[model samples]
Target: MMNFHIHSTWSDGLYTPEIIVREAIKKKMEKIGFADHYQTTKVSSISKKYLKMYLEDIKALRKKYGEIEIYAGIEVDFSPRTNIDELPDFEDFDFVLFEYVQDSLWDGYPLWMLLDLRKRIKPPVILAHNDLSRNFGATDIEAFLRVLEADNIGIELNTNLNYTKLGEFYYRLATPIFERVEEYNIPISIGSDMHENLELLDDVEDALSFIQEMHLEKNLKLFLKEVGERYER
Candidate 1:
């Protein structure tokens, strides 16, 4: 299975990058990624100066352990906590995750702002752990997804407990949006948002189940294709 969202010591997570990689291999995971925090405030995160070193650390692990596909990812807090104005191009990362987009509860920047920022970002971008039903439940679903498709933005099915509502995941709660996602060229990704928990390495099983139940396999493939293109470049 593939889990593209995770955290390690490069940010607020407890385990180091190598440790996370080793545990993922032990769990028989086919693919995984390190998506540590990249915020300016309210949390420990990767600053611009250490960004290159962070990518190199993951690069070394990819070479050391050829058993699994290791990807370098960053989770950008799309809120006031992040310095979006000075954000890097992130051309080196396999994929990018933007959390709290258009989330009023967190005072996140709106979708229009991210669209403007996307012009400068070359890598594939995914919306991380968002409550679409809460953020854009009133907006037209087709229009909302179309904007994402136009900008090449994907949505992440996160399995973190924090995102669950009365035992149902946020993605599950937003069934209306996901039900129609297949019709568009939008990509889909699954992640456990694992942090400080080794046993949760394979917690993405539920997310995988969601993809199959929703018939979003093609969307998943789209994301993999984007990641593969990065290798060719």
Candidate 2:
């Protein structure tokens, strides 16, 4: 098994990077990626100092364990007004998990610009909760779907919290996006997005079952790829 997306003390998560990887090992997780939140919830958070410290922690864990492959990443919040370059450099991590703040997830991406952003972000890119959107107007989700379909970014189906309770950004909003994400050649990632240790295995089975029902195993090749690498040991 592989939990490509996880959290730890790297950010606001409950455990340290070492404990996170250890738990994954206990969960029989062959691969683990500690992608802490780098959100826009606060005007000033996840500072440069913190991010560097987080990355170093992951590296140290990797050195000590050297048993499981650990990917240090961030679940980045893409604010509509967010300047991509100003988002700081994430090239240090294996990839950046691109999610949006429900309030400001951009619904417009010019075809050319979308392609350019894709090119600029190497290593790997994930559009977290790509199908997930705010519950405002139907037009918002429609606009988002259009932009996502046109881009080659990967998508994440966060299973930690029930998005439905978070108002309109949950249930109804992501159904269509999930369908479309599967239709396109874009890949998908199922993440527990767990914040606590006991909550670690939060919704893997259900999330996997959902994807399986949709016959989306192939569409979620990234997780499999990560699993394969981890198990190569």
Candidate 3:
């Protein structure tokens, strides 16, 4: 199993990266990533000054623990809390997660703004825990997904409780869009958005089931291919 979205002491999480890595190994996880908050006003985050240290920290853990693939990632709040214009070209990390895109409730920036910013970013980008059904319900599905494919952006199947409604996840609610996603080259990822809980390390079981139910194995493979390329480089 793999979980690409997680938090640690570098941001608002209770445990350190090492702690999370150790627990993941104990759970026999195949892959895990440390996606701490990056320069967001909404939470404790890693700034430019400590970015190198953060990457180095994850790198050291990768060497120390070969049982699981530990990737270095950052979660960027795509809202007023972040200065998108001054954002760095995150070529150093494995992948990036952009939260709250096109969500008015969080004052998130529009999709157009993110598309403009995508040109400067180097790593693979994934939309983090977004409620697509509500956020883009009015927009044309094909056109919206086309825009994402043009930019090579992926979507995350976040199984966090906070994003659930009536015991169904946001991704499950947007089943119609995902049913059509196979036609595009867009990637798909699964994340539990783990924060303070250690037992939730493998909570992505439901997400894995959803991937099979939707036959999105190809999209999942696309994301793994991107990550593999980054590692190969």
Ranking of all predicted structures according to lDDT, beginning with the best and ending with the worst: 1, 3, 2
Candidate 3: regions farther than 4 A off: none
Clashing pairs in 3: none
Q: Tens digit of lDDT per residue, candidate 2, span 1-233?
A: 65667767656777777777777767666567777877455333366557787778877888888767777767765654345555665667776786653444354333344356666654456766544444223455555555555565566666655444545434235665565555565566767777775445535676677677666787778545643443343
RMSD (Å) of each candidate, 1 decimal: 0.9, 4.5, 0.8
Model 3 lDDT, full chain set: 0.91
How accurate locally is residue 152 in candidate 2, as Cα lDDT from 0 to 100?
52
Which segments of model 1 are wrong by more than 4 Å?
A: none
Candidate 1 per-residue lDDT over residues 79-182, each given as its tens digit = 98888888999989999999999999899999999999999998899999999999999999999999999999999999999998999999999999999999
TM-score of decoy 1: 0.98
Candidate rank order under TM-score: 3, 1, 2
User: Local distance difference test, per candidate?
Assistant: 0.91, 0.61, 0.91
Superior candidate under lDDT, 2 versus 3: 3
What is candidate 3's lDDT per residue for 26-48, written digit by digit as tens? 99999898899999899999998
